[model samples]
Target chain A: MEGLSIKQRFQETLKSVYFPFVAIVVSLLFGSVVILATSSTSPLTAYGHMLKGAFGSIAAFDSTLIKAIPLIFTALSFSLARRSGIINLGAEGQFMMGALAATAVGVATPNLPAIIHLPATLLAGFLGGALFGLITGVLKVKFGASELIITIMLNYIAKELISYFVNGPLMDSASSSYPQSAPMEPSARLYKFIPGLNVHTGLLIALAFIFLYYFFLWKTTAGFDMRVVGFNPSAGAYAGMSIGRSTILALFLAGGLAGLGGCIEIIAVQGRLMMTSFAVPYGFTGIAVALLGNLNPLGVLFSGILFGGLSAGALRMEVMTRDVSSSVAVVIQALIILFIAGRQMFAFKRRYRYRPSSEKRKGKTVVDDATEDESPTVQATAGEGE
Target chain B: MNEVVSFFSTTIRLAAPTLLAALGIVFSERAGIVNIGTEGMMLVGALAGVIGSYVTGSAWLGMLIAVFVTVLFSAIFAYFTVVVKADQTVIGTGMNLLASGLTITVNRALFGASTSPPEIDSFGIVAIPGLSSIPIIGPIFFNHHIIVYLTFILVPIAQFVMFRTNIGLKVRSVGENPKACDTVGIRVGLTRFLSILYSGVLAGMAGSFISMGMVSFFTEGMIAGGGFIALAAVVFGNYTPRGVMLSSLVFGASNSLMYRLQALATNIPSQFLLMIPYVITIISLCIVSRKSNKPLGSGKPYIKE
Candidate 1:
């Protein structure tokens, strides 16, 4: 890339950029068809309302930023694991566990000073999700169980566990009818940073972690080892790196990130953990964000905001056009992932490229290029052979 | 005594969907494609079944439509994973999300976001005269929705085809080594595509059984994690038809027992009871996955050199 001239570099960037742009455009087009088929309102009108709701006002932009916070966290979680060759599908469950832990600490240890209590609650949330994630990692390492199936199973188990807590021990006694936890105390809550805006310090944490994610993955030795394992476990193992350790560490950190997102969401946005708190599915949406961003940290930040806008706008679209469901946003999100995953479908031409001298080196570079250029899903599946 | 009969009967009835879906998983997995999208296919199938029945006024027609739509859905999945050579698991995950969103959208559009499910024609028990009358054994097995019997009958047929037939041999060989299969003049891509489609057919049927056979209305998220459980059954069954059948029955019994225990007002919390199948799936996966009979080339997309 550094060897390329300015024009060639611009062309290369265009090549990388065009696919996701096309995917987003195609997905929105598909979304419009659904709107047209289902609602009496014109698709254009619905989209206009959606766009207005997402960015037309300070309040709308605030909501978009707020929604993007959790997504950024989950996307980081996914990107971390993908970098380590583990598919952390349990982020949803981990996020729920994080919220549960935050609630447990937030409600139980009330009246403490903000400094101690707030950080304590946040730490609890991280540990909650981290331990949950470690369960999958341990099972995979020790038992050879596929993380894919285990993570999914853990998600269902985590939901049940949440229900058990909310209905049984953690049920808010003041409101016996509602299966929800007691609200967190002032000290444990994530107070809004801007005076009138609804956004919280969680946005700062999300931004900080985005930088950390880039730094850790690209700069640190451990991160380099994990990426090597992800690229080719056999080669990494041959190079004396422990695959088991990388898998466990990656999943643990991934879970913690998601958990922290859940924690912040509870303390800042929701105020209390309710049975229906997971209705939006932040974890799955994160996968779309991560993929659309091409698994780059900065890219995830932008895509996260974009998805946040989509959801924020979708709510208004549903209201303005009562016939249309907000779930159309989900359809668009899913389509983006599908298109990104099956990107070869969008390729119309084979561009001539420069080749390295050694055939063996060329093969390795191709795999690396595939990892960077295409969705991480391709590399994850290819690495499964190890 | 009657309670015992009812319990076993409920077990079989509950097992039918998982059994059907697991049968599908067996076919797809045997052909070297990991179908994590079985859940999505089943979801679409359930909704399509209801829509078809609502329109045609026949449960059988609903079942046919369910199969048709699900096949079309899986065909897209096949096209991506087979022709486009995308990652199967990732695409499957996308398929699940798409299924969830699309079902909710379509269901809301046609039925108007009402909380109450739309009433539609559904399958009913067809008691086989002589067999259904066999006192103790008859009620447990003989009397069920037609799909239930069809589901059980397909077990042996699937077993026969998977183990005995030429097509099954080709499918297994292709999964084991696609390049070798290609070398032997087998059309690897076509075989895999068909195997995935066959899985789609059975998964659709399984889903139809859920909406049209077990109940008379469509509910959002009705298939729940039934598709994933079926995926587990495929693994626990060691990728064989008979194994998958037994695994499905085990999972079905657990589900049936959970509901029964909850109804009986047992001391155990309903949440804990509800978690039994998922927990059991994880445990069973751990126990069975040790031998690891997973297809050598299952998750990897085949690229002919």
Candidate 2:
């Protein structure tokens, strides 16, 4: 709760940036070494294709952003729940439910204009996902069931339910075909921002949600309650916060974001619910996005893009390289999660910053600075500190 | 009547792998560390055992190798979760993902991309000579593969070890109150590490049973969600070997019922019939939550003061 001046705040931010930044570089370095050992080809050439697939061409970059859009929402959903100290592993299920709901809405409302139809579909998706997550949250709070297991089990249940619906009630009657819903009306889809590009305004909406997430988490009373409950429910209760309410709210809010992701995925990219195969597993990948982004909304925005880039590139690499499949990116993602989970990055920071020589001096400086606040003293090197 | 008996007997055989895996999970989780990676561990073991048996042309050797390699990785897994203080949940999830990726990658490289490996008609039935006269009881229970028989024997042995042995008491105590046990001179972390290693052996055995005993070969994600089902059984059994065995039997029965119901196809679609197992699981889980008997500090690892 201690508020610092602009310069000191900048210094604190700089201190915190090292862990995530270094983690990325180190993980990529390891990926490079792995590439060299396995491929027996220059790792650079393969990485060049990775770069080309993500950013070398306008088409590639746009597709990357398109893939990134839903992830930003799911990651933001994860971050919101995480800040309050609950795990929302159900986001993938929620996201899928959202897609199912939106597809139903999109197909059912073909006569409506784009403006009316699009938002309605999204709202349905959001509500579906949010409600799905809320069921687990409510169960955990009311009945002491574990949300982690419930969500995992619910994922299979949800998938089967959707398959049943699509193959039966919602099956497109035009053709005897796969278990996929009818395509959305062109009017129901997101309008592409650039003339011929696949990238649409969904990215803009996702970014907007990211900003809202940041504001809600960092600058609101309810956000404070969520964070307090996250820190410790007993303490939060002592502080007059309802832990149950916060947990429920956090899950639904997170689920709402994921629902939006699902809506965007269907309406913008696939224009239909893409049948899940082992080939592309984007749902689980959101956890990596949330971790790589360090569970920050804006950070998730970029990390989502990074993963999307990997997703874009790795698919190509599978064909272009032949020996290695796109699933190799999975190893990299796992390594990132593995390294980050050890708390080693944070502990390493504590070790360096609390070095014996630095600690005594820094401790003295902290006391001195606290006392100096009484005098309103001005100091030089503020720019360097910032 | 014969159809019903055969159906149930087949269910027992089908559930043998899961029953064994659930028992494995019971050992590990009772020691207080969650082993959600049981699925991945099973996959790796299944692959390694199949490959080993294929190359060596001896199913027993392959099964042994699977157990060793899986136990080795479990040690690595133990080191990270136990020694490094890595979060078990994340590590477990990573294990599943890693097994899936590596299995396919290695399978392709070795066999040039065949999904099914060569069948080893290696594992044989353990037909007890005197027990055969017992009719349905003997056929349903005693007459089975060597591993299945071993599994049946081991469940009782596991129950005895967990309830009767001093080491078992210490393991359970470490899970419940590691601090108190540590104060009294028990090595909490080491106990957990050993328990996890024990789990690895049983889980490996289960996987090898599938590859060499259940099916003739291995396929990607063949373990599929069975490992997770074992996980549910562990929790549902309240961490007792007997309880775990019973739950695994129930799961096995439900799965068998689904297949039978699918075959009947009187009115319901096969898809709907296919959904029966998961639907039953969800309903059972909901009921279980309303009345869970989870041990205190079930997921918390002991941190010695």
Candidate 3:
């Protein structure tokens, strides 16, 4: 730090920000080609419409924030689990379970006051999601089963369970037999901060959570331990930390956070527990948010909003363009992932040299170079392994 | 007796797609790449198969296009995981998203929004000469499409190749210990890349079977987690071709039973019945032989010096 000049430090910061920016631009440029090939709409006009729709009016901006709120929560979930070196692909299921529990409580009590009902419903959501996440954690910890497959299976089960619940057990009796639960009691409803706007206090809750995530992960002992376990289980075990406990704990917290996101969506946005209420692929989109944010809590907030804007605008793009569905947003999200994963292309010359040495360390160096952008602890673990 | 015959036939039919995809996973995972993108590749293949059949009016042409498109997707996966040394799981997830978005967008462009594509020609049951006449066994085994027959034939062939061939040994060795394989002059990246491609082809076939053999048209999410179920089958099968086949059969049987019970309007909620295959797969996964001979470097990318 002392040796580097101010110019070098500035350059480093610029590099960190510039790569992702370039990747996004490149992806959009490629996306335009897709738009041209698939549809007759000019990419420039379509993008103009997208920008206009995302921020055209206060209402549009409010909707964008509304969409971002859940993304922030889910992104935090993915970010937290990744910190512990676990992948929680079942955020979709966890989010659904959270919604289910919150709905169960939200719809069951129509007479309670807002002060009590809201907190209870939110708690139910967190607990539901946590419990659901814990199943995968427990399975991985106890039976050594791969959480990847287990979580994927759980997603299928959760979707079916919710479909059944809305269609049968929790079906509204008087609403023309739609596959949805009865509307929530007014007490359980979330209120908008701005009267006419779609934005709700859920944004504040999401922001608070972002702060909490940062605090828990960066400033707490448990977070330190979890990060240690994530970077290297062998080192953590050697240092007397329980890897299983950390895995369970990390996943549980992740699920709980995501579950809270689900609750907010139900109480604030949807107001009803329809089968399709949480069907915006928030959980999967969260993965994109977390990765784009470099798994940093603060980064997640910004990335979440960015993704929200993309999604919010995508609908308008679909309406204005020919054959350009909102699904193009998904393609963009995936493109971002591909770009991030393959960002090695941007760093190739700087990081690698055409050294003719046939040393074993050469291969190890390449491996180290690939994982370099990850957390410092992963770098440490790589050194130890070698 | 007739009901029993139908149930068994349904089981065979249901198992075929999963069985084929699981076989693909066996090759890829054994070669040190856990191809969770099987789902994405299958999605691509399913849509491509529909497009091919729609344009060419031949199911076989659809199958060919499915394989070709899936291979293209797999190549992207190979470049990232094999050449760039990125995280396999994340890239695979990205591939799934890419496949999902691309398929839907293309579907909207080619076919109108919210409307299903026109039904195309699909493979009907090919009753083999003498074997198909042998009562219940014949009905279950012999009365299937050409793809179904191909899927069955693939089992022993895959088993023989994986166990008896030199390429199989190289693939397995690379997964178990790539460093050692590299030291021995074996091309680890090339092996892993080819294995992924092989899985792509198999998963493509599975996708085609779903569209052309199981149904005559493509709809949104027609693959419906069949790819993941195939992954479960691979794990449950202990990564053996025969084991994958048997586990796929079990899943298929449960899936068939669920459909049957739903048709019968059983006292049990149809939703819970619908969950039988997934729940059973999770349970079976837990109980499966823990002595899974998985490659040590199964999910790790090889980095060449």
Clashes of 1: 0
What 10-residue stretch in candidate 1 chain A is worst by lDDT? A357-366
Residue A271 local lDDT, model 1: 92
Better of 2 and 3 by DockQ: 3
Identify the CAPRI category of the predicted complex in candidate 2.
acceptable
In order of appearance, the predictions have TM-scores of 0.95, 0.88, 0.94
User: What are the RMSD figures for all models against the true structure?
Assistant: 3.5, 7.2, 3.6
- How do the residues B39-86 of candidate 1 rate in per-residue lDDT, one tens digit apiece? 999999999999999999999999999999999999989988887777
lDDT of candidate 2 over B38-83, digit per residue (tens): 8888988898898889888888999899999889868867766776
Evaluate residue A97 in candidate 1 and report its C-alpha lDDT on the 0 to 100 scale.
Answer: 94
Highest lDDT: which candidate? Answer: 1
The DockQ of each candidate is 0.50, 0.24, 0.51
lDDT of 2 at A334: 59
lDDT of 1 by residue, A208-285 (tens): 999999999889999999888877777788899998999899999999999999999999999999989999989999
Model no. 1, DockQ: 0.50
